[model samples]
Target: MTGARAMLPLGAALALGLWLWAVRDLPWPGWPLDPQAMTLDQIRMGYGMMPRGVVALLAGAALGLAGAILQVVLRNPVADPTTLGISAGAQLALVLATVAAPDLLGPGRWPIAMAGG
Candidate 1:
């Protein structure tokens, strides 16, 4: 792989580790529906829930990789999750889920939601 390509995973790992470390000590805000309110400690301490910080970091990295792939495939600098309608599709899916099936927003829902996108 090219240097930039080779560094991608390493960078993602570092970023993810940093993110998990940053939130590992924060208290969960007791908002079940809000991802931001969730914390690494809460995930470890209660219900065996996965860490929101890791989830967020992974999601960010995934999106970045997806965008890079799209841009390269399309030969367009502007190609991205937005240009591919992925962002809109994800938003629509979340809106529908929130309105029609709020239960899907619970723990372990992120991967499902992302898959839906």
Candidate 2:
């Protein structure tokens, strides 16, 4: 367990290093941050790709945490949101909210989805 815990940070660091290396060639925004100095590629990379990557990383982490919590709470190693219908319930709630009250779909969506799940 200790070895596994020790390896976690190392693995995360390796993954982050690889991600950085993969995007190293993309034109990045320069320091002293002048928006006018940024080229189109820099703008695309900084605004589009960087944010998308960060969001994906965070979403993956959140899903992993949720899965871990579900497994622990259910005492089932294979428990997942899909298997428990949690995802389906959340999706249904979101869809219903979208059709019923589109205005509630913005800031209050999380609570609505959690209620359904």
Candidate 3:
């Protein structure tokens, strides 16, 4: 376990290297090491792809964790956010908030979201 813990950073580095390598030839020019030299399209692609990777990982993790917690707490094998009506309630609240008070999305918006939830 200690040996595996020591390799965790290296493993993360390897994963990052592989991810960058996979996108190295995304119809873009030169590397993005020096942002000043990167074209607007290349910069855009880099930023866009970073979020695609980060947000997806985060959202997936959150949902999976939430589902697991809900199942455990409810003592059921399949109690997800949707099953508890949280998913729908939040969406409905967000839609209503968007229509009634679009400003709620600007800052300190989470309380409103929780209300929706």
Pairs of residues clashing in candidate 2? none
Which stretches of model 1 miss by more than 4 angstroms? 1-63
> 14, model 3: CA deviation in Å?
16
Candidate 2 per-residue C-alpha lDDT over 2-83 given as tens digits, one digit per residue, 9 for 90 to 100? 9989999999999989988887887563533666888778777777887998899899999899889999999999999899
Cα misplacement distance, residue 95 of candidate 1 (Å): 1.0
Error in Å for residue 115 of model 1: 3.8
User: What lDDT would candidate 2 get against the real structure?
Assistant: 0.86
Worst window of 10 by summed lDDT in candidate 1: 45-54
Prediction 3 TM-score vs. true:
0.54
Better of 1 and 3 by TM-score: 3
Q: How would you encode candidate 3's per-residue C-alpha lDDT over 1-117 as one tens digit per residue?
A: 699789979988998899888877675655668889888778877778767888998997898787878888899887777788987888888889899989888876677768877
TM-score of each: 0.41, 0.67, 0.54
lDDT of each: 0.73, 0.86, 0.81
Q: Model 1: which residue pairs collide?
A: none
Local distance difference test, candidate 3: 0.81
Q: Which pairs, if any, clash in model 3?
A: none
Provide the global lDDT of candidate 1 against the true structure. 0.73
